[model samples]
Target: MRLRIRPASRLQGAHRVPGDKSLSHRALLFAALAEGTSRLSGWLPAADCEATLRCVRALGIPVERLGPGDLCVHGRGLQGLRAPIAPLDCGGSGTTMRLLMGILAGFPFPSILTGNAQLSRRPMERVAEPLRRMGAEVHTTDGHAPVFVRGGALRGLRYRLPMASAQVKSALLLAGLYAEGPTTVIEPAPSRDHTERLLAAMGATLERDGEGVTVHPGPRLRPLDLHLPGDPSSAAFLLAAAVLIPGSAVRIPGVLLNPTRLGFVEALQAMGAPVAVAVEGEIAGEPVGTLTACAADRLGPLEVSGPLVPRMIDEFPIFAVVATQAEGTTRVRDAAELRVKESDRIAALAAELRRMGARIEEHPDGFTVHGPTALRGAVVHSHGDHRLAMALAVAGLVAEGGTTVEDAGCIGDSFPGFVETLQALGAEVEALEDPPRP
Candidate 1:
């Protein structure tokens, strides 16, 4: 797929993005572990979340698809999962693979998990090593996927995470549910807490002790009956479009306003983008809100590091686009984790953005952008990364000429209606099937 975008005067309207992907994954998995039928609304219908749904079904959980964003899961309690006859394929979702390892660790059977080529390259040792400490027989293929786990008796572990990872933390907590004692995970800095929030709402015994979360075994998780909030990460691209294009104003309502996930919005504000946030209420123990962003006359530079890196990690690709139009240098560091995503985001962002005439430098950990330079349209590639595809599209909205983004089909992995939403907001963008090679 290819996305051809032309410069837009402005973007306007109240557009709601898809349900939070992170929350969507946790909801389905947690509901599958509960005792009764769980009805979930506003669930994400993207490729990644679909992978989790498929894995849950393979594990003998019955799920009914009521709508595009709704589901009914019949859970059979903590130890109810039946062993799969074949290996469970997770598609391209790291969350599905890591979280499943934790859940499968306590069952008295063996299961193998595999994924697509991209996922197979992602390191699973971070998750596999800890599951091993808890007495689960876990083996990874040279620290990658095609992981094997044999469930059995387990003991709780007090493991301190070497880095901040919500996936790793959630995996351990999920495994803790079946262990003989309390399992605690300590974080270097807080990551997204969707797993913790959902676990507590489902009646799990969860404890929070400054940078640490402990989940004790033995509580029956209650079924979730709640509507999930929109993904803030997805909303970031739209908001960045508004901020970059002159005379633009856009609003997104009912977005997940978790502090750990709002770093992108905060970064925009620091860079002088006129972004407004209002907390309306809570859903499933996570804060929900509306966000309004308008065009900024000029955006200042931003310097990101430390704890803030993980919060806005996913948005850096789009943020790199915004940085191109800022008045000064925008530097990002401590985000070496970006290297291990579906693509090496640091190199991809730097390479693709530079193709569009931005002055940028790639670093081993992050990148540096010196901007306020006029951008000219050029053909760019998504590197098979969804966020990179969307970010490049936003850059197209402000560039001088038509911008073509190649291999953009990956955008459906997270934001399904990305092109349509931008067009509805009055951005001149079109999606087309790529021409055959001669």
Candidate 2:
């Protein structure tokens, strides 16, 4: 795909982008697990969430899309799903694979879960090992995808994650749905808690204590009324665009600010991006706010290291590029999780960011990008990573001339309107069909 961008005129106003992707997934899944209808507004109609919707619907949840980005679900209630006639395919969504495995663990029959090639290659052992300990019959290909979940009969226990993973945490918590007693999940390094919050909202007994959280099942869940907030992760791109362009300020309205998920915002602010939280409010227990991203001076090179990596793991590639405009070196570590995200993001980002003239070093876990480089446009590959593709496209916005992204179609998996949204903010972005290869 060819991206043609020139000097962009400044953006001076606010724009509302799409709803939170994380909330969208949880809303659908939690609603499916609840006992009645869940009315949700502001769902992102992107591919990943749709993949979740599809999988749940296969198990008897009536997920209805009411126009663009709005959905109403007829929930199955806890333990209400009948066995699916086929193996549910999540198709590149680990969110569906891991989370659903937990939900299915307590049902009366057997359920099999699978994903597309990329997701299938991801480590399911994170969830499999923990659920195995909980007395749930779970099997994987040594530790990867194609997990088979045998339902009925479970024992809840305390399990601390060896790593910080919302997926893993959510899996154990979901299994706690039908466990004999309280199922405790202690994450030494915390991950996103949208699952916990949404579960609690739906009448699931979930509580947090410091770095740990616990969930208890057998309580009847109230049907949800979901009004999704804006996706901060989605807005991060346009925010970066507005900040990079001099004399620009773009305001994203009503974004979710669940504490564990706000690492990207904190990282950018720490690096000196002029960002502010505005329009603060609460909807269904998740904090909602608007983010103001403005053009600013050079940012100090920073470290996106440590336990925070899992919270903002999906945003690291673009965060790395944004690091390029800052002075000093940006160290991204403990993010070995990136190796399995959609693609091997660490290697993919290091290799493709190099195509755009970024100075960087790579480790098995993560990469360090030494920035303040004058980036130039060149041919780059997405390696089939959605965020990496969009991150590289963002780099093209400031490159001399522009850049061409191979397999740019991957962006559709997450932020579907990424090109259009940035273009509206005065970033000259054009998407072309991938040209013929030699």
Top candidate by TM-score: 1
* Model 2 lDDT tens row, 56-145: 889988887788787889887787787899999888888888889888888868888988889888998888877878787889987887
TM-score of each: 0.99, 0.96
C-alpha positional error of residue 360 in candidate 2 after TM-score superposition, expressed in Å: 0.7
The C-alpha RMSD in Å for every predicted model, in order, reads 1.0, 1.7
Candidate 1: list runs displaced more than 4 Å. 435-438
What is the lDDT, from 0 to 100, of the residue 336 in candidate 1? 91
How does each model score on lDDT? 0.94, 0.82
Q: How far off is residue 388 in model 1, in Å?
A: 0.5
**Residue-pair clashes per candidate:** 0, 1
> Residue 7 deviation, candidate 1, in Å?
0.6
Candidate 2 deviant stretches above 4 angstroms = 7-9, 435-438
Q: What is the lDDT of residue 228 in candidate 1?
A: 87
